[model samples]
Target: MTARLANKRSFPHPPHAPPADSPALSIFSPIIQVFSRELQRQPDFDLLLAELCLDHVWTEPSKRDSKGEVANKMFLSHNVLSQDFANFFIGSLGQLRSIRVVHTVSNITTSGTMFTLSCRDAAPIRDGDLTVVLGLDNSISFYSGHVKCAVAVIAR
Candidate 1:
């Protein structure tokens, strides 16, 4: 059976031109790194394309097949995606803390966790500011070949 990425993006030609690490692609570093690592687990699995928006990491694999081999691979990628999204949007305690302190491994709710992506660091965040919120879907499974990381951030 033919396989596809989570978002099922249109697969272009086979002329592979995977990106090399550069400053421009820094925000997507987390997904790229995670996807690259998974590529190693499957010798035939090459990363044809990758795009990280909000919380989901969409990719066009060099080849697609049943999700029999990369079960553990998706687990690792999803784990990193959640952490990076949280850190980039929610920030640390002093950055954007709530009255209640809750410690959990992942902030993935069924409705998708809210966090921020992209850069908003030229000026320091003041007490009152409105930022575009994004959400990442936590209950997704890339191994199932249906990864959906949908996500946001709005705070003082």
Candidate 2:
């Protein structure tokens, strides 16, 4: 039997990236990309990402500087044993701006540590949907509970 050749199929090319003059994508691109990969890998990624995003979107506007910018502050206290660990973790908060250690009560524990941090924003948190904020994940948690505790305290 004789065989016939078929023409190659063509698909349309995606439009070019937005022009530089265009307004930048609100600060949620990285979060979207990372969460997208996570979602592809695991079914529960959305739940995890959603929970984490909640903390970022929750903030108090009462604590702001004269310029009306959020001036987040932290209260870190630790015993001799936890001093180094605490400092190291705090240092991990890279380029920490609008945040400071306003109150510190040292020697609060014989061999433990504590921190009370509050994070505010220039604008009030949105009622629904992801509110994009930059530099949120510059710091990472070493221990299991560190991130959750920090987020909870900051939101409060």
Candidate 3:
């Protein structure tokens, strides 16, 4: 029975290639294939791809250039810091076009190093988040008395 079963069934051969005129064989297919191959060549492609995918989605009017074609824009904001807790801000322009850094001030006085950050735009921080890291060289200190500080955001 085992010998008869082995001879009874045969698997079909795999297709060598997709048909030339198949709708799936459009120019985008080859471009996607090449893009995927190129992405595979990069060591950190997966991480980069994930970050790109996670960026924000926004709708804004398109400005026409000399070419005069409609374009879409995307905006995103994020923050990052070193293990030592040095502050920094990462903001994304529409379509990842540019990045703006928010200036951070570290004041070292008799009390301690006080860190302050100011945003240029007067608009409320819609998608703002902060991250803090404490390190040996840059540790947070508590003062005996309450300290008051005021922050103002001036728009351009």
Candidate 4:
């Protein structure tokens, strides 16, 4: 089995991947709401991959770029932190396009960070489903959080 990251761990795949006809998933809704409330409390903010398809090349790695392949419909922000709750799915736009935000933060004055997930054609997140969550830090960073334990969940 191939590893999702340097760490050899896997989660539900193609099966969990939302079908082309499925609705947008809101697995990140709660997290979105939490950040929304934070924005209400603070002064402001701003913001912004894909491995939907697996490629295997021993020597020269095969990479997929949405721009080069417009026909490639499946792309996403794999919420590994959430145990792949968001799983694999067809996104309205690629991972980067999926998230949006405005920055209005300053150490002396206003402070806040909010990002919007555009699920234009995504599916609704079911109860108990996993999704991405954010982490607050002393300094701004791209991603945070760790997987205390990650057991593989391969396709049967």
Candidate 5:
């Protein structure tokens, strides 16, 4: 009852890097550099969270919940200016349970740019709330639901 092995040569590696002058390569280099520099300057979680609270784009019915209430659900969008900030925050914090890109359609068209971050395991206490931080020039905004609670902030 011995099992036979499949051929190993069928999975050869792709060709070497593209020539230096390739337009795609040239365009990609600067993008990569900017990404690397941004990563290097990633901010701490508290700072990021604070920024989110200030810049959040509230959906229609911009209402506030009573303090200490926990939001079981909420949604945030990349178009809110907070998405990029959250990405950098979570990426730098290295504590995200999962990050998913969701597609949403507006009244007249269908498109997508929103990122849904579920931090259940990573930030269990704040799991159900939508929190974000936006970084625009030198300004910062922070926004979160009443349910959002972070151990990092509690300790302070």
Candidate 6:
């Protein structure tokens, strides 16, 4: 079977380019390092675990058989992701206290959770303050205030 493009977008091939004087190599690198250390010590850290959960997906659409019925299979390894989306998620992990994902897939349920995370940073443009909507078909879920409270409690 051949794949069809339902839509398309035209953006810079590489969304972000590393500069000659990148922050990673700048004098402020120490400050950034302290900030990351502080973030890790704040609460139930485990950045690695959070990262895995943030990227994990239970079921993905397997290749269709001759009959064209999409076969559902457990995602064995990592999912193929877009650079833009990956950057958004990584940035969110640093800014937000916690992110929660809940996926419910059963025989009779086909509806997923819908939620948004609106960032109101100092400069919307440079900080990339935007609303992200995720999860479509009983797959991904996000809860903001609840996650904050949970993280707060864990930190305490």
Q: Give me the candidate number with maximum lDDT.
A: 5
lDDT of 5: 0.36
Ranking by TM-score: 3, 5, 6, 2, 1, 4
Q: In every candidate, how many clashes are there?
A: 10, 0, 1, 16, 13, 1
Please state the error at residue 154 of candidate 5 in Å: 50
Instruction: Flag regions of model 3 displaced more than 4 Å.
Output: 1-21, 47-122, 125-156
Stretches > 4 Å off in candidate 4: 1-67, 71-152
The Cα local distance difference test for each model comes to: 0.31, 0.31, 0.33, 0.32, 0.36, 0.30
Could you estimate the TM-score for every candidate? 0.16, 0.17, 0.21, 0.15, 0.19, 0.19
RMSD to truth, every model: 21.3, 20.3, 17.9, 26.1, 20.5, 21.1
Alpha-carbon deviation at 25 in model 2, angstroms: 23
Q: Write the per-residue lDDT of candidate 2 for residues 8-125, one digit (tens) a residue.
A: 2221322455543445543557788887888799875455343212123224354542334332432223222333212111223322222112223532222233333322221112
Q: Candidate 2: which stretches are off by over 4 Å? A: 1-11, 17-50, 55-66, 74-156
> Which pairs clash (backbone N, Cα, C closer than 3 Å) in model 2?
none
Residue 80 C-alpha lDDT in model 2: 24
* Model 6 TM-score, 2 decimals: 0.19
lDDT of 6 by residue, 6-102 (tens): 2223433333654546765586778989989888788766556632333433232346224433222111111122111111221322221112233
The C-alpha local distance difference test score for the whole of candidate 1 amounts to 0.31
Model 1, TM vs. native: 0.16
Please give the distance, in angstroms, between residue 8's alpha carbon in candidate 6 and its true position after superposition.
Answer: 33
The list of candidate 5 runs beyond 4 A from truth reads 1-16, 43-156
Q: Candidate 1 residues 1-156, lDDT tens each? A: 346563345544333633455465677888988988888888886456544223662232436424322211111111322321122222221121111112345543222443223232211112112222222321211110112233233343
